[model samples]
Target: MRHTDDKELIRLLRLSDYAAFEELHHRYWLKLHKLAYRKIGDRQDTYDLVQELFIEIWEKRGTLNFGEELPGWLQKRLWFKLSGFFRKRGFNGKHQENFRQYLENQGFDKCFDPAELREVNACYEDLLAAINKTIEEMPNRMREVFILHRRQQHTVDEISDKLNLSPKTVRNQLDRAIARLRRSTEAYDATALEILFIVWLIF
Candidate 1:
């Protein structure tokens, strides 16, 4: 099983082969953990995120589909996990500064001079302002629901009960609110759009 190819391991996984699953876990655990740690900057959170990724993989193994590259697929799933983690925490000034430091530590200074870094930070702030403005422009009820769910860290069920709405309605409001914010990004240029994507990931 240790020498089995990814495709073969995946095949065995779908059939509920424990050895193959263990082998796959052993193969990627360190690499995934390192990636998660770099992005999250917390040992415990990184461990939890990577563990959750593998658990999800196993739970959905029966429906799993890998294209040409299994590693890429796993990494993509991890990226989504990271995005969700940041979203649940609610991005604020501290996280923005941490991300900037992360970039600098990754040698972004070699790619972007001090002036360019300042410009990127400015664009990032501007995009955030635009998103907040869009959120504020949402319908009254929608804005309330979004604030409760996102800013106040309330779950859909909690928001529904507080607002006297169905959970489905709360979810719909959130979906529409997110869609409106996405549309607002279209007005930005490429650089701003790139910053918007990063904001989306952490927001």
Candidate 2:
């Protein structure tokens, strides 16, 4: 009767209730679409990924735990699928090259085993979510500086010119943004912390 309860839906799902699956799909599909679109930046790919995600969810429904963290689990699964896409394309050269170099510069040189890589990639997804949360919590000027530097990939001088602020002010704002993010994520485990550091290094 509790159709909106994820635990109830998951219970029905495990029992092969198509309607329950449909309800879950209806609830989450748009949010998943936006998430996939933001990550892949390709409309066709986002649609394909969303389709694949739900199909897999249905096929594997019996195995699901139906925990409170199902949404986070879904996000981690999507990141894994996104990594597979990157692997198939051999990382598209320049983007992967820059990412790898950025990590190396942050003192991460050892090759990650498949399991390690998957874990790190999942942490990357978590860090992205954390960054978004931190940005939303930041003061307006600090948020502007953070988004310009992180999302738009602007240089300090570039952001200063665009925002009509002195370069020192821009740098200080950026530093404050980083400090805020660091404080927010301080509770993460050591390995996830390293992944977050790599993300900051790259941006």
lDDT of 1 by residue, 90-146 (tens): 444444565556445433534543233222333444455576568759999999997
lDDT of 2 by residue, 51-148 (tens): 99899999988886555766766765665566555445433333344455544543444553222332233344455556556767899999888778
lDDT of 1: 0.69
Clashing pairs in 2: none
lDDT of 2: 0.66
Clashes of each: 0, 0
lDDT of 2 at 65: 59
RMSD of each: 16.7, 8.3
Which 10 consecutive positions of candidate 2 have the poorest summed lDDT? 112-121
Count of backbone collisions in candidate 2: 0
Q: List residue ranges in candidate 2 displaced over 4 A.
A: 1-3, 92-203
Which residues of candidate 1, in runs, are more than 4 Å off? 92-97, 102-203
